[model samples]
Target: MSPAHVLEPTYDTLRRRLLMGAWPAGQRLEAARLAADLGVSITPVRDSLNRLTGERLIVSQPGDGFHVPRLDEAGLRGLLDWHHAIVTMALGRERAGRPDEFQLTGGDLPERSAHLFASLVARARDEELDWAIENAAARLGRFRHHEAAVLAEADKDVGAIERMMDEADSPGLRAAIDYHHDRRRSAVDQLIAASRGGQII
Candidate 1:
């Protein structure tokens, strides 16, 4: 593994802290502060923040610094809806056709996984209306690191889930949905646990 692998875990740990209301919204991200806390360089922190920005978990302000986005009811619902819609659409048998093989072999991943995550992020960028609402309580300064971590896991599962997705006619879609949802729920719990450690809040 590369040296970067050691730092990758920081991204998820940081993102969750921001999401769980530890930092709140509209706060500045001090690179020096994070470096001191995480015992890493500033580069990783900056990279982590950029990743979070794509997720709409944090907003980047030109002069005001990085802010935890403000998410209202509609905004939160929109993200939740988008997540459900995309997962349903791509994995639903009715839409994507026959199921591909579900494979999670070791080694390099395919481009499809990157594409799906990018698409989810693109939906957020296309609109500012729902951007801040769902992530309102996030501590933007903290989660840049954690975002990277989540993306890594999500990246790994993306292709397998898409390939395994059942056609509407098949009985597999429901099971796939349940399987993916359970994984996501576990991730959420891990996020919450990491966030509430009182480092940011």
Candidate 2:
């Protein structure tokens, strides 16, 4: 088998760890240590780190090495704002021809939330736009994992969205989306505060 094929599993494993907040933000990811921990060679770890850098989960510097991204209030706000704009555009298209009812499957709250957004984005009928939103959503998922309060509150937001979907209330749906973004912004603020206070290690 090709070396890249052999390393695919290791890459996936590391990606999951990064998304699940296994490492604190700003922590340097040493390839040697990660390979030792994962029982793999450094090659796969390096490859994974480079891939994650492209995804914006981690960044590499000439001398600083690879590290999980750290967001200040402004940076966090910018990310959230970007997410908001893309999702709003998607929702607008969804509202244009919204159905009378909607459905949500059972499972993890975050996964369900993702399904809600994906469903709306799918309505846009633009594959490239959907791809861009999904890509950004994946990157933002890491930030969501960094704050427990955000995840807990996301359940309520998801339910609100579900209700809006069932009623096909476009205005209500927009309002719910706004509320969700507000909560996420607050969560980012709290994370910044905690980090400054040395509470987040």
Candidate 3:
């Protein structure tokens, strides 16, 4: 197979695994081992790691190869704040219509919440904003599984956001967004501990 063919799948698989927390934070990603496990050559794994590093899904050091980013409280707060800003900006824009295709009621809480945010962001009709939200989401995805463990009524909170979106209540939606992010912001320590102790989802 061509390098392009090998590279795309390798990149996609690694990206999925990384976002899903397949490896713990701060663990070194060995390209050779990953290549062997994925049944690809080391070159493609290295290339994929480099691409992921650029996307901020993976981190690289001069002599340390690549490793999963260990998010400190400050780092995690920065990401949450950044994502909240993007989503809030999208909400402030006047969209032509809702994303009718996104089913907010049909998945696990995290998946549904993701769709809800995607639908909200899609309304902005700005590619750059979409890209920014996606990048933020990917970086934060691994920590999402910890939310349920730390946050009370997590599902209800997401449900309220969904309902606000469905009802076209912009003010309510914005408030819900603030509450959602602020609640998480306040519980950063619990969230970090939960993520560290919990099994990889």
Top TM-score: which candidate number? Answer: 3
Q: Candidate 3 — what's its lDDT? A: 0.82
Residue-level lDDT of model 1, residues 1-201, one tens digit each, is 215674576677677576445674456677668867988777788778778788767778777666666544344444444555544443322223333333334423323433333333333333432333234223222322333344446553555455543233245644654554455444543433333332321
Per-model lDDT: 0.49, 0.72, 0.82
Off by over 4 Å in 2: 95-107, 146-153, 166-169, 193-201
TM-score of the candidate numbered 3? 0.90
Return the top candidate by lDDT: 3
What would the per-residue lDDT of candidate 3 be over residues 8-73, giving only the tens digit for each residue?
999999998987778888889999999899998999999999999999999999998899998889
Ranking by TM-score: 3, 2, 1
All candidates' TM-scores?
0.44, 0.82, 0.90
Q: What is the lDDT of residue 135 in candidate 2?
A: 67
Count residue pairs with overlapping backbones in model 1.
Answer: 23
Put the candidates in lDDT order, highest first: 3, 2, 1
Off-target runs (Cα >4 Å) in candidate 1 are: 1-7, 19-21, 94-201
